[model samples]
Target: MAQDIGRVHVIRHLIEKSRDRKIKKMIEKMMPILLVLAASVCIATTFGILFTLVFETFEFFQRVSIIEYFFGTEWYPFSSGNPSFGVLPLIMGTLKVTIIAMIVAVPFGLAVAIYLSEYASGRTRKFIKPVLEILAGVPTIVYGFFALTFVTPILQIFIPSLKLFNAISPGIVVGMMILPSIISLSEDAMNAVPNAIREGALALGATKLEVALKVVLPAAFSGIIASIVLAISRAIGETMIVTLAGGAMPSFDFSVTGSIQTMTAYIVQVSSGDAGYGTVIYYSMYAVGFTLFIFTLLMNFIAHKISKRFREEY
Candidate 1:
């Protein structure tokens, strides 16, 4: 009887093992289908957005002259008499803030990235990296309010010409908001440089700083440029900080201390129910969004090209 019981137990264990193998095979077969479904969702969403923007922008152009909209300098879409729909001022505002943000973020971000990748000890990097990432994760609305209440006031102390709502404060805050992207991505790129290269340079009597600047930096150039481009795209799409702190006054002036309205800010204003649905002003929002979309797409394309062109093979 004991021998018969052992035989039964062995048979049951073999059956269970076979069933587990079948389950594992089934899961492996399902993974590709699941991944394809996820990719399809993303593709569908992108097309949906593109179609919406195109349809609405077409409607806007039917009512407003495309030539005037593109080349006209005035942008008073809410005028009581004749509302102008020129996009130049909005474009100028967007570019001004973006330029200022790049100016502030690029140098500082690259410097910090170099420091973290080349000089920081493992423990120090662990602490500092998380802090920078946390700063990045902080809500943009908070940054907007910080710029409006804090930075603007501080700037006013130095430059009495600074307005309560101006591009400078928001530009600086946006720069701070995008710092983590530049720092984290650039540092990762720098770290990806082979240790063998560093050793080889050092063996030839190259100093650490020299190796980092001349050798590692050139090797990581593509990644750093891609990171900067991504940051520029983020700065362009930033809405709350520019809307709240950069003011709602659209202007062609490039002065950093002047109040300006970006394409996103104008979209916010139009979408805030101030313009009735189906009004030309409401349709103008789509036009602005489509324009913003084009700018971001161009930036991404440039990043891809630069990454591909300058990428270094291991």
Candidate 2:
């Protein structure tokens, strides 16, 4: 009887071990599928939101002509009187901020990246990198306040034509906000350049600046372009800075010194408390959002193309 009991215990232990091994193997086999599902979640969510926006936008356009939505010159959806739904001024406003931010961010960001990658020592790079990228972590509202309270006053002195809530201050602050992304991504790309390439350039008597600008930058150009496009996308979508620093005036003008409102700012304005749900004005928000979605989607596609177009494994 005792021998039979001992044999039964041994069998139970073996069975438990076998079960555990099978479970582990099953999980291992499912790992890739699980990762793919996780990736697909983002795509699914994006499509879902896009579908919702399109459905709502189509409904809005049914009430207002598509031509008026796309080409009309005025946007007064909340006006008590006749309300117009023209998106051109909003598009222009978004373009103005984006262009100014790019103009400020591109050269400055590339310069900083080059200096950090080529000239800065270990300690300097360590100290400066975090401090610079820290700006990215700061809230957009805080930057908005800085733009309005701090930068605007200074600009008013230099360009007296600049209004209290002009586009220039917000654009400049957005550029500063965008700087961290450009620097970090550009630095990563520059660092990824083969050290052998740098060595060859130096062996040929090229200066550090020459190697950076001519050799490393050209090699990392695709990544730099991706970073710039992504930065511009962020600038176009930014809300708090532009809403606070840029006045609520939507105009067809492009002057940075003048007050203007971006698409994002207008969306924020409408969604916050312009009208009740199911109203034409309320539906206009979705139309604007859909337009923004298409713009950003195109930008993402371009960035993807640029990145995939070239590969240097060495």
RMSD of 1: 4.5
Off by over 4 Å in 1: 1-38, 309-312
Worst ten in a row by lDDT for model 1: 305-314
| Clash counts for all predictions | 0, 0
Off by over 4 Å in 2: 1-40, 312-314
All candidates' TM-scores?
0.88, 0.88
The stretch of ten residues in a row with the least summed lDDT in candidate 2 is 305-314
Report model 1's TM-score to 2 decimal places.
0.88
Clashing pairs in 1: none
Candidate 1 lDDT, 129-236, residue by residue in tens: 889979988999999999999999999999999998898999999999999999998988898899999999999999989999999999999989999999999999
Best by lDDT: 1
Residue 182 of model 1, lDDT score: 94
